[model samples]
Target: MDAIQKSMLEKIADLHEVPEGAYNIRSNGALAGRNTTANIDIVTKQDKPGIDIIIKPGTKNESVHIPVILSESGLNDCVYNDFYIGEGADVVIVAGCGIHNCGTDTSEHDGIHTFFIGKNAKVKYIEKHYGEGDGTGEKILNPTTIVHIDEGGYMEMETTQIKGVDSTIRDTQADLKDGASLVIKEKIMTHGNQTAETNFVVNLDGVDSSANVISRSVAKDSSKQVFNSKICGNNKCYGHTECDAILMDNGHVNAVPSLEANDLDASLIHEAAIGKIAGEQLIKLMTLGLTEHEAEEQIINGFMK
Candidate 1:
């Protein structure tokens, strides 16, 4: 293992022993190996009222599970495994991966994350994948994640991916119960010749349940990207989905958004768009005597601003 990777594993070596409760894991400067794999398993019981996790890389798989035991509601309100957000409690989870190198050898990676949020509970989730300056070659990864929330619960999830990756398929699922709310935002930026695909699904299953999904992607050079977002609503629920992409140079991006409503009392909306840097806007800034790099930087700052 490289120094950075070793250091990261060492820091969390005792992760299996940490007493759970609002845990945060960060590996901003590490990388997962080209041929490495990881599986994390977490067990969260009511008596513990904490978080659990597993993170290590190499072709090895990792897995984690948080049992959803409701303190009030019965079994009918949540998903399987009693993974509902119980009344008044809160749970937050973040799962991410980093690669140091993906050489010419076609390395493959697959990551799966699953969660069950209890009724009346709140969960804030942030997931990110990053790798920069590694030149191995043809790298592919597929990440699948699931989340379930109960009545009056809240779920917020944000995901990001940056550098050294050729392609990624990310799938996310969430179910909201009565009066529950779910908000998901995904932002991705790709450089060099790469391709990425992202997919998200939100289900509003109860009365007054609300869901929102926002997706954004930035493609540069010869890179390509695709984003698919879907929202479904049940009885008296509300759902909204929006997808937007920015293209630069010879890069290309495709976005598909859809909304489904089973009940007339339910509301749903969906929109998508793909476009390049606004030349008129860039020219206006260039007229100010800014260099090419400065002009490009200004546009990027504006996009993110």
Candidate 2:
């Protein structure tokens, strides 16, 4: 696949072609294409690089597309992907990664993903990360996600990083049981001297377990952003966490949300908001003529959609 790896797979997994049932595509550090159907199964992890996605028992409308692409120069790629959703399954998973560094040294990728969602399973996971060229080296990404949900399980995760990456670190962890439920949504954008970090830890052990975490970020030039969240409720649980950030030139943002409740009908909540970009929303989009950098890029693309 040329044309800069199919335009980095249509900006991370909105593939223009070659997508149906189960799929795996990786470039610059191995396997370029693969497919498996009939209730989905794609294996190849003889104790090494990546791939093992299996969804069988009572599988419904199925889907899987693992996407990773890096364009050679000074490559450092690492991966270990795993997902098993069985009992009463309903599935959809589209993983995404893209990088195309032109020269001068650093282009790194590290991904470790694991999810096992079983009894009464329902899973929807979508991820997107992107980077581009005009190189002078660095475009580094580090991602790690782990989730386990069992009795009456349900999981939903959506993550997006829509900008040329210079450095990123994102890690997520979750565990839930009886009447389990977990949901996470994160969107991030960073500009020039870019650096971003997000970390989340959620544990709602049993008895009507529930969790929700959300983060939205936009930091422009001279960027630096960090958000950390933690939610823990042992039994009879419910948890919530949210962080929102937006900043402009010479931007920097730091947010922390934390919560823990041991029992006694546990319920937890946390929220944070950082400011910038609302001088009457750039004078109401410059009286509908749109100039302040196109009304702050249309309010940061409608607040990252």
Candidate 3:
């Protein structure tokens, strides 16, 4: 791996070397490396911005990692990744992007990912976005994800952006079939005049289908954030959406959660809360031998986790 790729992997995956049976891609439309097994096929799309990954049928207990890195300044990279999972294939996918820009120019990455999961398949997907540099430049990201789950399929997704991103906008949508389930968890933290906005929509289109959407965020030091989530139920299905945020030091947060049920047997609900950190919790921690700053940091960390 190159110096830039090594640094990015360390920050995002905390890995020294690329793991066995994993795939790697760089932001400059280069295939950094890959180690595939018999159960998975990795193919580069010559006419597209990203690759296509396919999992064989009945393949179980498999894991794949696709990490993207950008080292140059003033660069904008857009990637479109597509995943096709076969029937009864159980897998975990780790995907993330890290940027290092050390010049006075803005760096941005916009990724569009689509997943097609077959019947009875289960997938756990995790994605993270991070930025680092000591320059007067902006690190921006805009991600769009679309998922389709077949009958009896299950998908769980976790996405996080802890720090260093100057701006971000996230959009996610999902469609679930009969006996399918989807769960999405999102976490974000922003500071220093940063801005973030997230929108999610889940459609339960078949009988017994279900979906849950949860979002947690922290904004501090003049930062601003907004979250909007909607769940639509079309059959005898269930859906729930929630958004919670903590704001500090001139931070501003807006949360809007909506639910729509088109069928008489459908059930849908939503909730949202935005507020500052509790004073009593901070005081209790500070009395336990921690300074005010330390207590606040600890609380924020625990809350985001």
Q: Write the per-residue lDDT of candidate 2 for residues 1-305, one digit (tens) a residue.
A: 99999989989989988898889998988998999998888998998999889899889888899999999878999999999999989988999899999898898889899999999899999999999998799989899999999998898999999999989999999899998999999999999899999999988999988988988999998989989888889999889888888999888999978888889898898878899987997998899898999899999999999
Residue 75 in model 1: lDDT: 12
Please report, as a residue range, the 10-residue window in candidate 2 with the lowest summed lDDT: 255-264
* Candidate 3 to truth, TM: 0.97
The Cα local distance difference test for each model comes to 0.60, 0.91, 0.88
**Runs with alpha carbons beyond 4 Å of true place in candidate 3:** 2-4
- Among all windows of ten consecutive residues in candidate 1, which has the lowest summed lDDT? 67-76
Tell me, by lDDT, which candidate is best. 2
| lDDT of model 1 at position 110 | 52
TM-score of each: 0.72, 0.40, 0.97
Among all windows of 10 consecutive residues in model 3, the one with the lowest summed lDDT is: 22-31
- Clashes in candidate 2: how many? 0
Q: Name the runs in model 1 displaced over 4 angstroms.
A: 1-3, 6-87, 287-289
Q: Pick the candidate with the highest TM-score.
A: 3
Better of 2 and 3 by TM-score: 3
Query: What C-alpha lDDT, on a 0 to 100 scale, does residue 235 get in candidate 1?
Result: 81
User: Residue 282: error of model 2 in Å?
Assistant: 27
Candidate 3 per-residue C-alpha lDDT over 1-305 given as tens digits, one digit per residue, 9 for 90 to 100: 66876878877765577666757557544667777789888887789778788999888988888888777788898988899989999999988888888888988889899999999999999999999888788999898999999999999999999688999999999999999999999999999999999999888998999998989999999999989888899999999888889988999998888788899989988888888889999999989999989999999999889
